[model samples]
Target: MLVTRQKTLRRFWYPVMPVGKVEAGPQPFTLLGEKIVVWKAADGDVVALADRCPHRSAALSLGWVDGNAIVCPYHGWSYDGSGTCVRVPQRPESNGLKGRVVPSFPCTVRYGHVWVALGEPLAPIPDWPEEDDASYRRIDQFYETWRCAGLRLMENSFDNAHIHFVHRDTFGDIDNPDPPQPAIERLPYGFVARSDVPVYNNELQKKNLRDDSAVTIRHITARWYMPFLRRLHIRYPSGLDHIIVTAATPIADDRCQVVQFCFRSDSEADAPARDIIAFDRRVTEEDRAVLESTDFDVPLDMNSGVERHMPSDQPGLLMRRMLIELLAAHGESEHTRHDAGRATQEQKSSS
Candidate 1:
C-alpha cells in the first residue's frame, strides 16, 4: 500500500495554526507532510519557508528570528522573508552568498487562522460569509487532532447520516434515527447538501432555545469547498442561526488537525461561551472516537465495493467521487491503479 503524493491537493490553502499562536519566534509546522517554518517579519507579516536551511540542511525552525530574518542555529546564516540569504557571519562582505535562497510558501492570515499555500493556489482562502456578519456572534475557536487521514475527516463532516447512530448520546435521538435524503447541488468549487429535518437538541442546547415547543423543525445546509474546507448552516424556527466552519489540515498521511469556529445569531452574553464550548467539545469528542476507530485510513473508491452505503450516504458518495476525480486528474491515483492491478492478478491466479 504505497501512498502517492497528492500534488494537486497542495495547490489549495490549508490552515497551519491559529493566528495568535504564531508569535515572534520561529514556529515549525508540517503541511502535506512537508516540514515548514512560520514567523512574523519586522513589518508583522507572516512568512512561511521550507524548514530546511539552505546551508548544512539544518532546520530553520531550530534557529532564532532576528529583526526580519531567520538565523541558522548551526552557523550564522540568516534568511529574510523573501527566502534570500541576507547575512552570512563567516563571509559578511561576500556577495556570493547573498543571493542564495530557500523555498518560500505563500501565507495569509484569515478567520483567526494562518493559512499557507504550498503551490500556486487556485483561489483565495475559503471562508464562510456569515463569519464577518454583524448579526452573527463569533464564538471561541477550537482545535482537535484525529489519527485518521484528512480526507476521512472531511467526509465525516459532510456526512449527515452518521449523526443519528454515532452521536446518539450527544445530539442525536435514537428514537428518530432515520435522516431524510438531502437535496444536493454541485457547485463550481464543491457541493452543497440541504435537508429539512427534525432537529434534536442536548440538554444544554434545549435550555438555550427560546422555544420549548414539542416539535421543532430545522433547516440544515452543508457546503464543502474544494480540497478540505466545510461549513454547516443550521437554522431554527425561532430565527436562531448557527454556523460551523471547519478546516482540516493534513499533518501527515494518517493524521490531521481540525480547527473549528462556531458562529451564532444569538447574543454571546446570553449564551456563555464556556457552556457552548463544553457542549461542542462533547459532540466533537464523540465524533473523534468513532472516526479514529474506522478500519480504512482513507476513503474507499466509490465503485470498488469495499464498503456498503445507503441512500443517506449520497453526500459522502459524492465527496468520495469528487476526490477520486481530482486525484485522477492530477495523475496521483496510484492506489486506484494498484487496486486494479491486484484484481487482475487475482483473476489470473484463479484461472
Candidate 2:
C-alpha cells in the first residue's frame, strides 16, 4: 500500500537525514508526501516545519536561518520553530501576523538520524541499544533513496532464502544453500526471528576473522519494529558480533529513503569501518538492482493472491499480516479526511 494514502501511517516517526548534516540552514526533505524542512535554533534545538512560507508560498528551505526563526526568501517573512509567523517584512514591526502559521511536525534525533512525524505519533521512536553502549562502535553506513517501498525493503531484510540466488556474487554459495529455519517470536514492539544461515566466507569474513575458512555459519537474530526498522545480529565462529540496523523511511508511493548503520564489537584496529561499509554497499546494490526492476509496492492484502508465495516466504508473509492488522485497527475515518481536506484548503488559500 502507498503509505501517504493512509493517515495512520503518517503518525509514525520516520528518519529523514543524518543529524550531523542538519547544519547552517533549513534542509528540505520529503517525508510521507510532506515537504518539510529541518533546521537548528540558535539554542541548538532541532526545528522542523512545513517548507512553505505563508506569505507567498516560497520554499522555507531556500531561506537562511536567523536566530530561532527561518526567514522566507520571497517576501522576507520569518517563522519560528512552532511554525508561528514571527516577522513580516512588508508590514510594520508593531503589527504581528496573528493568524499566519505553517504546519509543523514532531522532530527529534535518534540513532544519528533526524526523525520527523507528519502527524501525532502512535508510538515513541524504536530504540537501538548499541547507540548508548560504550563497548561497541556505531558507524553510520549509508543514507540513500531507493526505488522500492518500505515494506519490500523490510521484507527482503528478513528473508533468508534469497541469499543463495540474489547475493551469489557477494557471499552466497551452494555448499550450504540453506542452513536452518528461523524461529519466529512475537514481541510487543514487533517480531524477532532467529536462524543460522550457512554462507561462503567471502573477503569480508576473511578480513574480520583473519582466517581463510571456505565457509561459515551466521548465527543471526533478526528483529523488526513497527513500520520499517530492522536489526540483524550475526555471530561468527571467532566470537565476533556484527549488528546491523536499517531504517526504510517512505518518501513517496514508490520510493523510500534508507538509512543503514552498523555496530561492531571489535575496535577500529581489528575491523576497519571502510571495509565493512564497502562490503555492505555492494550487498545492498545487488538488492537494489533487483528490487528496482520488480514491483514497487508490497501487496498488504495477502488473500487477494497478488503475488505468488512459498514456504520460504514466511518472514515476508508475517510482515504483510502485521501491517494488515495495523490498517484494520487504524484505517482512515471520515474525520481524518475532513481534517486533510481542511488543511489542503488552508494551503491553497495561503498560496
Candidate 3:
C-alpha cells in the first residue's frame, strides 16, 4: 500500500536537512512525495515552505534566500517565512502580492537535524538525554539517499534476525542464526526494545576496544519514535557506550534519506570519527542492497498473506499493528485502504 498518502504517516515530523546545510541557501527536500524548500532566515531560524514558485511553477529551491524571504529566480518573486508573497519586482509592491501566499509547515531544529511537520504533530521530537550530558563525544555521521522506502529501513533495523546474515562481515555471529526474542514494551507513539546478542568482534570493535575476545555480547536498548526515528544505546562489556541515532526520512514511495549520528564514550584519540563513520557506512549499505530489491511498500494488513512472518519478526509486526491502529484512530483506515489499492493498481497499470 502507498503509506505516503496515509494520515498516520503525514501527521509527524521528518528530518529535512542538517542544521549546517540550510544556511547557505534554499535546500530542497521531499517527505511523503511533497516538495518543500528549507532555508535559514536572517534571524537564524530555519523554516520551510512549498517548493513551487506559485506564479510560473518554478522550483523555489532554485532561488536564493533574501533577508527573511525566498526570492524566485525566475521572475524575482519573493515570499516571507509565513509564505506571504512580500515582494514582486515588476509590479507595485502590494498590488501583485495579493493572495499570492504558499502553505508553510512547522519547522524546527533538533538532534542536529532540521525537521518539518506536514501536520500538527501529536508528540515532541524524541528526546536525547545523552546530548546534554556533555560526556559523550558526538559525531555527525551520514546523510545520503538510500534506494529503499523509509519503512523498509525502519523495519530492517528493528528486525534483528537479519544482522547475523546481512552483516556477517561486520559484527554478526553466524553461529546463532535465529536470535532470541527481545523484550518489547509498547509506548504511546512507538515502542522500546531490549536485547542481548552475541556478535563477532569485527574491525570496528577491535578499534573501539582492544580486547582479543572473538565475540562480545551487545546490550542494546532501542527506542522507536513514531513514523521514522530510531535510537540505539549499546553497552559493551569493556564499559564503552555507543549510542546511534538514525532517522529514515521518506523522500518518496521508493526512496529515503538516511541521516545518522553517533555518540561515543571514548575520545577521538581512542577511536577516530572517520573510522567509525566508514564502518557504519558499510553496514548500512549492506542493508540498502537487500532492501532495494524488495517492494517499497509494506502491507500493514497482517491478514493480507502477501508476506510470510516468522516469530523473530515481532518488532516489525508490532510496528505495523501500531500504525494500523493509528489509522483507525484517525478514522481513515477503510477509506485509505481503498485508495491504496487503487493507487497501486494504477501504478501497475501504467507501468
Query: For each candidate, what TM-score against the reference?
Result: 0.90, 0.91, 0.94
Lowest lDDT block of 10, candidate 1: 1-10
RMSD of each: 4.0, 5.0, 2.7
Query: In candidate 1, which residue pairs clash?
Result: none
Better of 1 and 2 by TM-score: 2
> After superposition, which runs of candidate 3 have C-alpha atoms over 4 Å from their true positions?
93-100, 334-351
lDDT of 1 by residue, 1-351 (tens): 112266777788888888777785888998888999998877888999999987799999989988888888999789888898988898878732555489999999987778998999976776467767988877756876778666676778767678777878766766776778889999866899898877577678775665666446778898888767888888888888878888778886667788888888888666777777887788888888987887534544765666787877787778778777776877776354456578899999999
**Candidate with best TM-score:** 3
* Backbone clashes in model 3, listed as residue pairs: none
lDDT of 2 by residue, 1-351 (tens): 767787888888888899987785689999878899999888888989999987778899999888988888888888888988888777866354676389988999888888999889887887677788888999899999998888888988988877877888888864556636699998765799999887886778688767688888889999998788888999888888899989899888789999999999888899789988888898999999888776765677667566898777898889878877777788642223345578899999999
Question: What are the runs in model 1 whose C-alpha is more than 4 Å off?
Answer: 1-4, 95-100, 211-215, 334-351
| Residue 177 CA displacement from its true place in model 3, Å | 0.7
Ranking by TM-score, best first? Answer: 3, 2, 1
Order the candidate numbers by lDDT, best to worst.
3, 2, 1
CA lDDT, every model vs. true structure = 0.78, 0.83, 0.85
